[model samples]
Target: NLRVHLLEVEESVDRVFSDDSTKKAVNLLYMYPNGVNTVSSDIQGLTESSTNLGVVTTLENSIEYDSTARSS
Candidate 1:
């Protein structure tokens, strides 16, 4: 189940980053102070929607998934 969740996160990240609607390149670093790293992405452009920040929203959702998985 954990593996499946992780795969889902991977796919979500890939899909969001690969989207062509994004305009400015950005990097997302998912790291822990304890030196544990889960996921990171250095990709080109974020979505152009000013009111709807797609990257941030997606990352937040990803973090929620991570938290839920951790608790389980």
Candidate 2:
């Protein structure tokens, strides 16, 4: 439910996967944050894993409520 938690999760995933471990990295990177925001928060430190990461975040929130760079 916190950014720190998200960062922890990201780092944990990063630690276990090697450069060649694309699938594992992608799966970890695709994980959604715990809280919902009216204006989507910036998701940093994550590699481009799922092609629909942005899309999934959008649909979960709403066009007006969802902008990856915008904060709650």
Candidate 3:
């Protein structure tokens, strides 16, 4: 019984936002995919600058990565 009610509520909420404007109002939580190479570092829960985290990866050239995302 509880599950059925929850499903109905979900459906109603979806219907309320089933419009172009509502969709546009929501900010995307994802970044766009790109072929460019860039250095990444873990800055989560840290107060230091990103540079202090150390370079995780970098671009070797116009078409290659100096280090992969898995390299540590």
Q: Which candidate is the best by TM-score?
A: 2
lDDT by residue (tens digit), candidate 2, 29-49: 546432333432365543433
Cα lDDT tens digits, model 1, 1-72, are 012132334333334544433322222222312222243244334322222122234452242212212110
Candidate with better TM-score, 2 vs 3: 2
lDDT top scorer: 2
- What C-alpha lDDT values do all the predictions have? 0.28, 0.36, 0.29
- The superposed Cα distance between candidate 1 and the true structure at residue 5, in angstroms, equals 6.0
Per-model TM-score, in order, reads 0.13, 0.20, 0.19
Report how far residue 72 has shifted in candidate 2, in Å.
Answer: 8.4
Q: How many pairs collide in each candidate, listed in order?
A: 3, 0, 0
| lDDT minimum window of 10 residues, candidate 3 | 49-58
What TM-score does candidate 1 get on C-alpha atoms?
0.13
CA RMSD per model (angstroms)? 17.1, 15.1, 17.1
